[model samples]
Target: MSFAGFEDDIGGWGPPVELPTGSGDIVRDAMRKEQVIKEILAAQDDLRALLSRVNAVQGDVDKLASGNATLQTYIDNLTMQMAKRR
Candidate 1:
């Protein structure tokens, strides 16, 4: 059977590989190779998605850090004013 439809599920890295019939050894080898290629492509896609999520989390951390600094400054200013009134 042709593996043309299988490539779409694995990120569509390339065209599908056609395996020959009638030879057990040759067909087994081809199927093994195809499975390895699909695994590699799937791993690559997973890594790309993980990197994108990491970048988004980093941006959120930066925004939180900036807001914390602003709040600290405001608190310090208020504390100074209160001390002066005491």
Candidate 2:
């Protein structure tokens, strides 16, 4: 899950190239980058929370399925007993 070694392989890269632009333009670009990063991180957190909830729901569904199988077995046994008595 870590990209730690990739940095060494791609290291020694020159600084990012920048075209001449007004100071206001540079400030706005930096602000936009910060906002985008924040939104992306927040979205990741939301997805993690959603995954946890989905796992819990799956557990509940499994329990219900097990209970239904037990009930069906009981019903089958009862039906066979009544038939034998008659």
Candidate achieving the largest lDDT: 1
Q: How would you encode candidate 1's per-residue C-alpha lDDT over 1-86 as one tens digit per residue?
A: 34865643553566775656546788787988899999999999999999999999999999999999999999999999999999
* Per-model root-mean-square deviation over C-alphas: 11.5, 8.2
Model 2 residue 77 lDDT?
A: 100
Per-candidate clash tally: 0, 0
Q: What shift in Å separates residue 15 of candidate 1 from its native position after superposition?
A: 35
Whole-model lDDT values for every prediction: 0.88, 0.87
Measured by TM-score, how close is model 1 to the native structure?
A: 0.67
The C-alpha local distance difference test score for the whole of candidate 2 amounts to 0.87
- Candidate 1 shows a clash count of 0
Per-prediction TM-score to the true structure, in the order listed? 0.67, 0.68
